[model samples]
Target chain A: MADLIEISDPADPRLADYRDLRDVELRKSLESSEGLFLAEGEKVVRRAVAGGFEPRSFLMAPKWLDGLADTLATTDAPCYVMSEKAAEEVTGFHVHRGALASLKRRPLPSVESVLAGARSVLVLEDIVDHTNVGAIFRSGAALGFDAVLLAPRCADPLYRRSIKVAMGAVFALPWTRLPDWYEALPSLSAAGFTTVALTLADDAVDIERAVEGVDKVALVLGSEGHGISPRWQHASDRRAIIPMSAGIDSLNVAAATAVACYVTARR
Target chain B: MADLIEISDPADPRLADYRDLRDVELRKSLESSEGLFLAEGEKVVRRAVAGGFEPRSFLMAPKWLDGLADTLATTDAPCYVMSEKAAEEVTGFHVHRGALASLKRRPLPSVESVLAGARSVLVLEDIVDHTNVGAIFRSGAALGFDAVLLAPRCADPLYRRSIKVAMGAVFALPWTRLPDWYEALPSLSAAGFTTVALTLADDAVDIERAVEGVDKVALVLGSEGHGISPRWQHASDRRAIIPMSAGIDSLNVAAATAVACYVTARR
Candidate 1:
């Protein structure tokens, strides 16, 4: 069993990694600098560990210890038991999901490595919302897309809300940040993958038609605000759309991704 | 032109419908008792009006007035103009989108009325989350589904979060609560619509196969916690599954709806 320590004070030094979690910028910088990310709830934490992430430590309500004991035993990290009140105080929000773990962030895999031997992939360009990023990843993973490649400015998939919303699919999916924004699509094209960008560009064909018979496909999605950048859109081998009914302009980007991923998987 | 009245006090009775906007239970009861619902943001407000819901009143920051002036010109409802800070005070949250409107709720159409002459419909069972309910409505409308029929227990589509998340598709979609849950599926089946419930039951066929060649279809979805109840599942003509990748069990209910709607629309 993991060593169990009782923590009464929310200000303890050991809890520094979890402080002020609701401050997005602070959490981003702190997590990026500390080389760590958080996994909340028992299942996600378990998935993180199972996916080969090393845990730095764990915090949970006392009642949750037994439920997670077997998994905690596999790690050398200390598990801190605290009152739910104290846990909330440290996190700056209610910790209702029962358990949290701070796990070390591994250096991301290279785009080339993720793309290698991949049949279907999702390439995201500056999707601003963390939840959207996570949902897209979950869809890509669930629907048999082989990998995810993110643009330089896309929101981090490792953010806490993303982790929870994705139900830990982030851990299971192979994903990497594109090294160069200027040449991202071209590299995928050069790699012999058909790069299909989801857009409403007038020339865009129905997604079903666009993805048909492609040996290897990279389905590109853009941010909700501006959609695929002009440069990226221009570089794409083809443009495709979901073809919504009149009067409804667009689906939520995440919803669009799910639809596209599902169709692409079937194709 | 809407009578532009300036209200400086947050506690004014005219603003009561907009008060405590964040209190779910309070707003539920208040809106129910008063037969009113709110549409936030300028675009949603325009949709609510355009969708034929009569406006009870309009509330907006001064900056939003001109943008909505043409729409307001079509209504006799009073427009209450207030400072952004005062608007925040009355609403219990920041009114960042710059406008909100209270609209009179019409008596919902009957299940028979909604299903009449409709080819594709969605039947939701006890989906408790407002956001999920909204997203489903958005998906159904975008994919050319003619109407939606909800079990009595489904989340309110008019709820604020549903409206915002759905981008006001709730106003555009035709939906009504099923009067009798037990007979809902049977009635649709009798009305010449094939009832296909999305489930993970072992016998469920691939969704593509489940929806194939159906002229009139009623696509059923269930809640996050329990999925479709056994009664509803058994009553349906057939059960369909999304056929997810092995390691991942399922997509988010909303994402599943979009994917299913996409596939079903094509079928």
Candidate 2:
């Protein structure tokens, strides 16, 4: 069983990690410096633990403790029991999901290690939206993509919103940031993966044609605003478009990834 | 040239349709009652007009007026030019997008009309999230899905956020609310559609296999929470899932729609 601590004050030093969550800059700094990121809701908390992430601590109301009993039994980390009011005062939002846990972030696997033994992969270049990043990870993992490789500027998948939107897929997927933005596709090519970028280049073939019968594929998707950089676009072995109906410019990046991954998975 | 009105006061009654945008319930009430919805940002505003949505009025800063001159020349609607501060005061948020427009919403076409001459379609069931609805519309439009039929409770496609997320594809695509909740799939089947519910039933076929050679297909999708209603599930001609990897329950509804649309479109 986990040790239970009662905390009456929202500003208590023990509750420092949970404070000012709406302040993204402060939370980002605090989380990185302390090597901790939060997993909200009971399901996400359990998934974090089950996915092999070490919990630094947990915060919840008394009612929440029951649902997480199995999760608590497996860890020595103390579960901080506080009122819902206290949670809002600390977190700057409603604690509607009833539980939150701070977990130690593990070192990301290297690109080669994540891609090892993988037949299909997703390469996200500066997908800045946390929700989009999380949604892509969920689709990638669900469709059984082997791994995900992110550009250096891609939003952190372990960020609270990403973790929640990904429905814990971020915990299961093996992913790492590419060391060199320019050489990202070239390196994947060297490793025997065909880099098919989802773009609207004139030379682009339909997505179905691009992924057809490819043995190993890295589906490169760019950020929502500007698409893949010109260099990455040129480095790709093939350019593919989803063949949109006239008047619609493009799918949201996450939606594009889903379609691309689905086609490549079948291929 | 379009008529330009200088509105210095944020409380101008003419701008009531654009007020309290962040308040969902209030906006829904006003938009529906007035038969109007907002289109935000330059790109979305342009697409809305280009996509055939009639503008009731336009709001923009003086600098924004230059780029939209051609568009304004085509419409007789009054364009309200306001200072940035006045725009914020009226809308209850930063008007960083520079402009907003109140577009008259056309009467929703009947399901039969939306399905006219269309072989591939998407059916959304109670997808409550506006963003997901928009993303699905975008994917449907981009992937060449001919139409969309939403369950009666689905979020409004013309809702501002949905239009923004859809990049105005909602204006281009023909969609209507299914008149009957329980009979939604059965009605589609009666209309010569192969109603394929995207579900996790044990007997569900792979989406690619499910759509192969089907002349007319209606890919049915449910909401984030409770999926397809039991009635609709039972009513669909077949249940099809995207065949996710084990331990991953499902993709986000929008992502699921994207994959399903892509596969069905290729068929």
Candidate 3:
């Protein structure tokens, strides 16, 4: 069983992992360098442990301890209980769900391992918003997409915000960053997957037509500000558009990903 | 032509409309009581003006004036020019897009007028998040949904965050609050729309099959946390689900809206 320790001071060194949660730049570097990721809320905390991640520690208000008693029984990780105010001071934000876990991030598996026996996948290029990255993962997982591939510049799916927005879907999905960005689409095609890029290119066909009768499908999405880059767009096997109404700009990247994944799932 | 006024003081009363943009409660009451709404960035400002919203005033750094010169030339509203830092001090956040406008809020049209001759529509119930509301509008408009109807408790689409995330689609879309939330679905059905609620009920049909052969589709979605209320779910003509993976939870309300809109558009 986990040891429950009552801590009054927010500046305790044992609580270092939870500090500066709102500072994106600082948290990104700290998380990566420390080789750890945070899962916030009771559901995500339980999911993190259930996904086989070893917890370094947990922090929460005293009230949360009872609700998480069953989960706490499964691990020997130290649980630091504090007042909600103190927890907010340590984390730089209110702990809305009242529980958090700092878990070790294992080295990412190889791209081939993630794609093993997978038919439908999402290939995201430069989707740098953590929330968008999280949302896309949730959509892909929920709609039965088998795996995901992210470009080098894509935001980390394990970020606290991403994990929270994803509702722990990030932990459930198989994904890793592409080792080679330049030939990512070509490599997928070589592996016998037909890459359908979601873009507004002149030759783009309707989304349904692009994925029809494909044995293996890889749906490609780009960043928020721009659609797909010219290099990737041209290199993709099929370019698809969602056939939007005239005079409207494109859907939000996450929304587009959901639509694309839904269509590809049925295909 | 617009009159350009240079102001270095952040406390100027003329800038009241643009104050405390980050505080949701403060901004809501202030904006509603003042009978105005804010449009941030040069593009949204241009879109708001183009959408026929009268401008109460414009606030921006001097550098943005050149890019928005053509738009400013079309409005007689006073323009306040301040340094980026001073603008940040007034607005409580960095104005990344470098321009803002306070526009007059015209009374929302009746639900009947918004739905007049509309073949496809979206009905949102208690979707309180500005970002989600904005995203739903973006997806609905892009996918050719004719209008949007919101329950009385829904967040304001005219909020600045909503406008920014929607990419000014809120200005283009015809939307208004429903006077009667309890009978909304029945009322839509009476108006010849086939009310399709996106819920996870046990008997929910696949979204595609539910919308198949339907004319005048009114796609219904609920709030972020909960699915559709029991009343709305049972009252709708048909219940539909997106057919997600077995182990996964439901999609984010906005992502679900996007996918639902995509299917409904084709139907």
Candidate 4:
């Protein structure tokens, strides 16, 4: 069972991981370098625990400590119980969810390994927005995509805002960064995957027609401002466009990803 | 042609609608009053002009004024051309897109009128997030969903963030808030439409089956934290869920809306 430690001081050294989380520590560089990830709210924390992310420590309101007793029994991490005011002060914001867990970052598997057993995967190119990245992962996880492959310039999926928006699905989904995007495409093709680049280009086939009867597919999505890169357009085995209204160009990248995943996964 | 009116002062009363927009005019409340709606970027501004939204005025960088010569030829609104730095100071942020248009809010069409010529429509239930609201509209427009119907509590589709995130599709798609959600469902069903509610409940039918061969359908989406209300659940002609992984409960509402819209609008 985890040790329940009572913390009255906002400056306690043991609470360093959870301190200033809304400001200093919440910055992506700080959180990433410290190898710590935050799981906010009770539900996501519970999922994080279940996903094999061992909690390093927890900062919770005294009221929430008792409710988490059963889940805390499975881990040996210290649980710091504090007043809501003190917890909020220490965290640098109003902690509305009443509970938070800090877990050590697990090493990611290689891109090749994440794709090895996957039938459908998502390839994100230059998707810099954390919320969009998280939403993409959430959609990918929910829609049965086996893995998410991030190209260079994509936002860090482990960033705090990404994790919060993703509802902890970032921990559950298999994801990895590819060093060379164009190089990664041929390997996927060699592994019997069809590289389908999503674009708004005029000559591309409709997405419905492109995905028909495909067993294994990789759906490539791009940033909102720029669609897929010219390099990706050249490397793609096939190009498909989501059919849209005459005046509108395309959907948000994350929303577009969900449609692509759903359509391709349906087959 | 829009009259060129160069302004150097941030305190000018004429620029009040475009002043402190990030502060005084909350995106949600911007539509409640006679306040001007903001359209950012050249493309969105062009779309807004093309969609017949009468621009009250334009705040733009001097460089952008030259680029917008063709678009400005047909407009009668004043064009406040300023340096990029002055534009930034007036807008309280860097105007990266170099142009913005302020338009008077047009009266929304009646829900009946919006649905009159529609085949596939999206009914949003209290989706308050501007980004998600924008994203859904973008998806709806792209997927050829004929119109979008919002419940009372849903965010205004004309909100600046929604318009920007939607890449200005808020201007392209036909949308209006229904008089009441409960009353709208039955009327939709009476209008030869199949009312399909997207839910994650165990008893819900698969979305694939629910949308099969439907001529006209209303795809209902709920808010992020809460799924569709029980009232909506009860009123829906059919309940359907997107197939998802066991651990993940559902997709982000906007992403899910895209999937549902794509499924229901399949040719």
- Candidate 1 docks at the CAPRI level of medium
Q: Write the residue-wise lDDT of candidate 2 on B147-243 in tens digits.
A: 8999989999989889888888888888898888987787788889999999888888988899899999999998789998888888899999888
Decoy 3 TM-score against native = 0.98
Instruction: Itemize residue pairs with steric clashes in candidate 3.
Output: none
Candidate 2: clashing pairs of residues: none
TM-score of chain B of each: 0.98, 0.97, 0.99, 0.95
Per-prediction DockQ, in order? 0.78, 0.81, 0.94, 0.74
Candidate 4 global CA lDDT score: 0.84
Per-residue lDDT tens digits of candidate 3, residues A1-267? 999999999999999999999999999999999999999999999998999999999999989988889889999999999999999999998889999999999999999999999999999999989999999999999999999999999899999999999999989999998999999999999999999999999999999999998989999999888878998999999999989999999899999999999988888
TM-score of 2: 0.95
Sliding window of 10 residues with minimal summed lDDT for model 4 chain B: B23-32
Lowest lDDT block of 10, candidate 4 chain A: A21-30
With candidate 4 superimposed using the best TM-score fit, by how many Å does residue B103's alpha carbon deviate from the native? 1.6
lDDT-superior candidate, 2 or 4: 2
Model 1, residue A179: C-alpha shift (Å): 1.7
Q: Taking the tens digit of each residue's C-alpha lDDT, what string does model 1 give over A69-131?
A: 878989989898999999999999888788999999999998888888899999999998998
RMSD of 2: 2.0
Interface RMSD of each: 0.9, 1.0, 0.4, 1.1
Q: Write the per-residue lDDT of candidate 4 for residues B195-232, one digit (tens) a residue.
A: 99999766789898998988899998888888889998
**Model 1 chain B: which ten-residue window has the lowest total lDDT?**
B109-118
Task: Sort by lDDT, best first.
Answer: 3, 1, 2, 4
Ranking by TM-score: 3, 1, 2, 4
Candidate 4: CAPRI quality band: medium
**Candidate 2, DockQ score (0 to 1):** 0.81
- Name the candidate, 3 or 4, with the larger lDDT value: 3
B1-267 per-residue lDDT for model 3 (tens digits): 889999999999999999999999999999999999999988999999999999999999999999999989998999999999999999999899999999999998999999999999999998999999999999999999999999989999999989999999998989999999999999999999999999999999999999999989999998888878999999999999998999898999999999999998887
TM-score of 1: 0.97
All candidates: TM-score: 0.97, 0.95, 0.98, 0.88
